[model samples]
Target: MAMAAPAMRMASSASFLPRLLPPTVFSTARAQFLVRQLSLPLFPNFNIAIPVGISLGLPSLPEVLEGIWEGILKAVPKKKTSHMKKRHRQMAGKALKDVTALCVCPACGGMKRMHYVCPTCASTHPADIFSLAPTPSTLISSSGSSSLRIHDTTSPTYPLAQTITNAHKLGCHHLATARGPQTGNIFASVGFGGDVKIWRQNPDSKEYELQWDLPTVSDAGKGDVWAIALSADENFLACTTSDGRIHVWDLAAKEKIQTYETGGGRGAAGGGGSFAMAVDLSRDGRLTASGHENGGVYVFNNDAGRMVYSLSGLAKPVRAVAFSPGCKRLAAAGNAGIIALYDMEHGEHVGNLSAPGNRPSWITSLDWNDTGDYLLSGQLDGKVKVWDVARGACVATHSETDSALWCVRWLPPTERALGPGMGKGERFCAAGASRSLSFYREATGI
Candidate 1:
């Protein structure tokens, strides 16, 4: 009994012992017949916080459903709408572009609002237009459906004068015209199949015909002729290759005259070069520039037959490159979506042009006006923006379709009777995945 009393006192003073043994029945019964008092819920509220994934594996579906239903109870729709929701709904309703009210202008026969200036000439087409070139009197456009169409921009109807069917069996990717020997009769086009064919405009009938094709260089790889740039004299044609070599062809001789290497070509992939994406010839014919898949921008002193600058601002593949009419500035764009401008004199990254709020869509084409005051850029999002070089701001933006825009070109400067209702001096042409040619004029730029 003394020993039992001592043990009971120790148990009351210490923590629970895992090896507790019950006393004999006689000793326990003789001691007391007291009943053990059961403990009710300590918190009464069983809303205990349980961590996620307490189960060794996945929980049952019914339990998951119960948790989901509990979450739903907390997210029940408000009986009274909040002001922020009302404001958002109102803004959304107003944000949609209202094109249902467009009607063709009687004077110019272009779609416009009831009483506003006719905005643009929306020409309907069948297949995606991939390239466009502007001659003195006509606009030539190409599409994937194996036809190149010529439009007479001088006329009120902009009538199609000719359609050369099956010009490219696999479709053309690029077309380039010389700057100013201004023959207005010669142009070059590069196809996806890697063939470079020259076209000549017949003065008599004003129809174009396949003039000549440059033979592939002895070591040129498959699908090598990707971009073409014609010089001002219309004598030398510069092009980029799949193997990263820039080849300049003498049109008069129909032979490749000079080859500049940035690696690639002869056993290049093992340790030599990358694909060249774009090429451009300066108006003066003194400089030639090319952009490559390695994000290299190389400006070659054509006379020196060597590279001058390998620019480095953009780390993404270069897609489009252009030299200003004066050849003082060069612009390049690519997967980075920003246009990097380089000073030709110093070969320094002078400035960058990008969209205001968001990154621009991949820039597919770039052009500068004759005076070098405005820069035209075409984007994959089917938008064409005209940027003012001096101001560094977007002067205008036009969206014609949801499809990607492949090319945009400024028409040769001309004096024409302004459309009766509008007042823009500049005319530009754009073609893209929609297979249509969209012409835009500066509502008041003349």
Candidate 2:
């Protein structure tokens, strides 16, 4: 009986053998076999019975291994990535494009990225463009470089029609062309060195040639000339000087014909009069108007050979002045950023044209359309505005750059207008510190 007791203990201890072995290496069948082998050897007379099925109070090897694999799978993602999530991950850390980084193309009249070479047109001057003048069929541009460039306005590409190399040794600042018929054959340019050169188009070849240069010594008080204007007949040239004197020269005789002084006898050494910044002649060749640095506008009767009116109202330096085609109204603007309209007949302050803003940009240049219905103005803030003269309101505004605008001009109407608003044939060009000329056409629904 004592031997049988030891066998019972052995069998009871065998039940825990499965728990001691690794779950992968242990099984229910192996547990039963071990118990039987140990019990039968200890007591042959005792009836040793081993259960076919045994419970170790734990999961089996196969069941435990499967449960462990399922837990590992739950730790990882199961669903496929969505399209939206994948796109977001791909686009992360990228910057959005700016909406205002665009401008109007000068050639094709389309939109393009600002400061980038336009795909439609890739034309530019080597240096800053300071002045722009338009003839009936050509557009002339002068820059800080010593060359004068002429572009064919009649062509879409604005192809370079002519290039006058070494036209000015010290760069050109101002250029003037006749505004009416019988004057397209001649033009004038003022250089930084204070010399005025006249160019005449050849009658047979249709090319411009340097006709003559005004001797600097012949100027009033030996002062430098700044602005110039030509008469409709192309027979007379009027120019402003640093000594606050306006001189009229007869081109046919090649001599100074008339001298109108604004300095009131204050010699050139006595701080002369305020510098005359701009000048223009009436279409009929009857009136001459000049704008000065002291914000003074003066009108003279060329026939009477005397000062007609000393205009007022502008408090800042005057930079530009123009007479309406009809010769009834005069428009002037300057650092004040406002356009003052004066009645030419009575020399009375009529009205003002200004945009809505607290600090408006300095007006650099002004021009009237052929019909005198609209006025075109270029500003230092890189803005060009068209004001309706009748309504005294700005009709259109264009901002294609952030650089200063030095000059703007309305291109003469062509026989066959091509772009939008062709029925009206209204087109204009602007140039400035950008060193490129930008052309814009009136927008129309068509």
Candidate 3:
């Protein structure tokens, strides 16, 4: 009876145990308890006792294990994320805002998006740049605009140093600077309005000012002047006319000293000779060369005052002509897309620089580096090429833009005014239909 009484009490006290065990376990225990009660006679030795002061609010095993797993997870270190990755993730769902508003370009009257470069207007000029001339410290650019802009090339930015507004009312087409030691102080420009203006740099202030303009009486002999070149000493100037006449001016006397006629009196009867599209004066002032629209390249003896050589080989219009610094070779290129090299002394077609393809882009401009070992050319298809004059091969080519390139020139090798020493190798600048100027430097292995 005592055992039976304790067993009854233990069974009643077990009501609080359901909190510790799951419902399924509690139900199974209850079923086992009923079976033991019914079989008490078979298990009379079994004893039941209620544990005193036991807590009933303890967690189940599964919940205790789950809490342990959570602690382990909290203690584990997290992977680090880079700032770039975080930025990409944060911007993943965002879209770029579009600029929809348009405005008129003040310079060219062309429409463009606000705060954007005008498609019709060139970098700083309202029209296409026609010529580029480099001094030791500055780069002079003449566009179809009335303004002539000078940029400081010593600095990497090539900042605009000065702007001569309305220098050419009808817009200038060609600019010429002396190539030797006496350069930078004096330069010349020919405008579309048939006027050639001389500009001289101030020795102290370093600012350029108008020296003089060509007299109108000179134009009576020949039509509009199209191109001009300066003598190495800056003492003389050579200009070409639309009627195939090459005129030399003594700048000091401000008088037309000599005139070489390529038109052979045909221009007087209104039948102009093939228009003189390009002209150059040899550095020694011994030779004057002109390239005409009819692919005739003529080299005149400046000392003898007559034509020396009538060069041939190119069948298309000649647009650009340049004499080597040593006066040994002359390079001429134009619509034919081939550069013709001529021996200046013998007036022989020495070689040609051309690509192997059937169709080639027209070469518009050409310049020789100071050493005369390399030649640079700009093409109508927006390509700039550097040629090894000795090897007769194109060494490098750059096609930064697909717009027509009108002018390209090599900056004279000089100590950078902003730096410690002279530039390592050759450097050049190009400008054209993009309305912007691009500068390139030779790649060095150092």
Candidate 4:
């Protein structure tokens, strides 16, 4: 009985205990069968790579390296920027020194900007240094060293405040300034080396600093360039070559706009024989006046892009031709030393601005003041004489230089003077071969 009771208790305890789990339950007999079926005994006994070759493809070492390099390169990131900063230093109201220009004379030390004052001696006496321009301040002069000078007209001693050097290699022979109600202060210069330099002032400042530079269209050389002129609005620049070619450049668009042949065979004729000598743009930018060595003056119409008039009055080599402020009259002069005023409206030789006693002695330079009331002529004998056009009289004769005067210009009246209720008249500037520039204004206060 005792054995039976213990057996029953053991059976009950076994029933209450949990069943034990097997460690290899996942290793089924079917899985083992599948693995054995997939096994390849030949490849396993030989090389594993043989089966890899059959399964995939073969590749050379170089090809593998190249592919690896391309993959690495593709995984790299690209840089988005450089080291340059966005902001820069500003130029304040600090006065710039070295603003003065020095002109050397044969006997004396350096001359001031006007060449009218001796800074070393503080002398005011005139030394007959050079014939001053009609209104000197606005007159900008250039030299062989490639520097441009602008003088102030308001002061009796016109002082230079700015200098733009390296304007061109060789030297500058011709320069022109634009005068318009909107764009009055811009100017241009041409060098013997066939390069043209255009200059403009900063609109925000009155300092008149260098603003931009234009590239040369022709190869750099002396004979390739002869003269340069700017339109009244400064939108165009016209340059003449010794080969008798005229190239018109669009300054605003910075491109070559037009070209015209002056008639030439290179080296066939003398310097002026085959090429154009001088070119001038009228006030309205509608007409272009060109003076040739053969004493031919042709007026080109900008709108028509054709020669409208060929003047026949002057037979002497026409050196300089200028249109009046109104563009109604044209003044042509040169080796003849005579100012022939023409009427563009009627295409007639209206009158002459030459004085009664003035002889034919190379009238190298001519300019009409802003008012068009006076005419300025510079002679090879270094005489700058202003003529009254209305009366055809020589109003003022200033012979300050014996050196040939190369260029002459009238400074436009200041805004204050040009404003309403102001009566300030007459101002101009003249530059010569003597390496000096002079400025002059009608002695309104003196």
User: How many clashes in each candidate?
Assistant: 6, 0, 2, 13
Q: Name the better of 2 and 3 by TM-score.
A: 2
- On residues 282-366, what C-alpha lDDT tens digit does candidate 3 reach at each position? 9999999999888889999988999999999999989999999999999999999999999987889999999777899999999
Clashes of 4: 13
Which should have the higher lDDT, number 1 or number 4? 1
Better of 1 and 3 by TM-score: 1
Give lDDT tens digits, candidate 1, residues 46-144. 222324433222233355577679889989977997889877977888445657756676647767644222335333345777788787777777776
Task: Give TM per candidate.
Answer: 0.73, 0.73, 0.70, 0.64
Q: Please provide the root mean square deviation of candidate 3 (C-alpha atoms, Å).
A: 17.6
Better of 2 and 3 by lDDT: 2
**Would you list the C-alpha lDDT of every candidate in the order shown?**
0.75, 0.84, 0.82, 0.64
| Predicted structure 3: lDDT | 0.82
RMSD for each of the candidates? 14.0, 15.0, 17.6, 24.1
List where candidate 1 sits over 4 angstroms from the true fold. 1-125, 217-223, 264-272, 421-424
In candidate 4, what are the lDDT values of residues 354-422, reduced to their tens digit? 656646578987888777888888888878889888898888988766687777766666644532233
